[model samples]
Each structure stands twice: as C-alpha cells, then as structure tokens.
Target: MSHSTNLSHHSRRIDLDAPLHRKAGPMTHAMQPVESAGEAQTSQACPTPRYLTNSEAAAFLRLSPRTLEKQRVIGGGPRFHKFGRRVMYAVTDLEAWAGERSFETTFDPEYIDRHPGVQRDDQ
Candidate 1:
C-alpha cells in the first residue's frame, strides 16, 4: 500500500497528542516539522528524536510539570532517566503509569471478598 493511504485523510501528521481514551494504535498523524531557532536553513531539518522533557511528560499526563517533578521526587510518578543534566521520560513508563489505575476498576469480586477490608462490628 502507498504511504499516503496509510495516513489519516483529515491530517497528514499523526495525532499523537490525543488522549489515551482514543483508539490505541501507532500515532496516526504525521510528525510536526520543527526548526532550530538559531540555525538558518532553506530545508526543514529533521526533528530530533522526541524524548519527553519534564514539561512534555507532565503535559502528557495532564498535570503541571512541577507537580510531576514533585511526584518524581516523592517516588510516586512514572520512572525516568537522566541524560547528563536532562531528565528524560520513558513513553512506556508514561503509558503504564497513566493506564495502571484503570485496572483497579475491573477487579475480581471473589478476590476482594476473600481479601476483605478492615474488620468492623458495625455491620
């Protein structure tokens, strides 16, 4: 199949920024082209391989980057790595962290019954 047909008809770029509630698939929009501000060039230089910065990762989670950083400091946020002075967020980590809570909604009732909560006589 031709590459053009594989792309969304409404948008040439894949719509990666859409939330997790959307269909699960490879990003559907074409990558947005970015240019370095300091360099002068006639052709569009390729975008650097995108890694989620603190702000970007926070945005991905719909929280402020500072809050995400706080979570990281508290050991409550998604896993991250340091590349020199830059902190890089893993896409898999972000996805896993973002989706992990949803699993709690579909629990096995028998399991919960077996593992009952704090015992109380006020039944």
Candidate 2:
C-alpha cells in the first residue's frame, strides 16, 4: 500500500481521552454577547486561578486529574505549590518534567524484525 494509505489507517486508530474543544466554523450572526449580569454569575462559578489548575496540569501531561494527584502524593510528578487548599503547577516546571522523561531509542536488528515491514525497509 501507499504511504498515504498507511498514514490514514494509523490516524484512524487514534484514541485520546482528553481532546481539545473546538468550534466547527467561523462565528455566525446569531452569536450574541451575554448581559453583564450573566457574565458576572458565570465568572463566579468555581474561580480558576491565574496559575495552572489541576485539570490543566493533567491535560498538559495527557493524564487524568486523579493520576496527577496520585503522582503528587508519591512525589513522582513535577514540583507544585499549594495556594491555600488549591494546588497549582508551574507551566515551565511541567515542561521541564516532560523533557526529563523523554527517551532516545537504540535500534536493534532483532527489534526491527519484530515490527511488520520494518526489516524490509532496512535492507
């Protein structure tokens, strides 16, 4: 099969739990600004801090929020701070944490053989 077919097949199998929310198209005429009163009430609903929230941190790591909390208790996650009862993570620290976990592979001939079509490509 062609490379494009292979890429399309691979892309179709993607399964991500946390997907980014997006609008389908450009704004329509029906889109109206809410009144200031409604805006004030909406803003009051669970105030998220200027810093990264637990959900944001989890999204950054591509993990569930509970998993992040578990890592925090076990000292396995990036360093964070508590602002009162709420836990906050630094964007820079999370980036550093991701970088530290990155790994480089040392390809082996046997390993290549285990992957379909890889051996054919090699030789």
- Highest-scoring model, TM-score: 2
Query: What is the per-residue lDDT of model 2 for residues 1-123, given as tens digits with 9 covering 90 to 100?
Result: 565434544555534422333333322223322234566687689565335788877776778999889989887788888989999997778878878665445266544544557766768
Model 2, global lDDT: 0.66
Model 2 ranges off by over 4 Å: 1-50, 106-123
In candidate 2, list every pair of residues with a backbone clash.
Answer: none
So what's the TM-score on candidate 1?
Answer: 0.45
Residue-by-residue lDDT tens digits, candidate 1, 1-123: 565554445665546545534545433433222333443253336534446889778767778989888887887688898999999997678888877545343255543544456223224
Any runs in candidate 1 off by more than 4 Å, and if so which? 1-50, 103-123
Highest lDDT among the candidates is held by which one?
2
For every candidate in turn, the CA RMSD to the true structure comes to: 14.0, 18.8
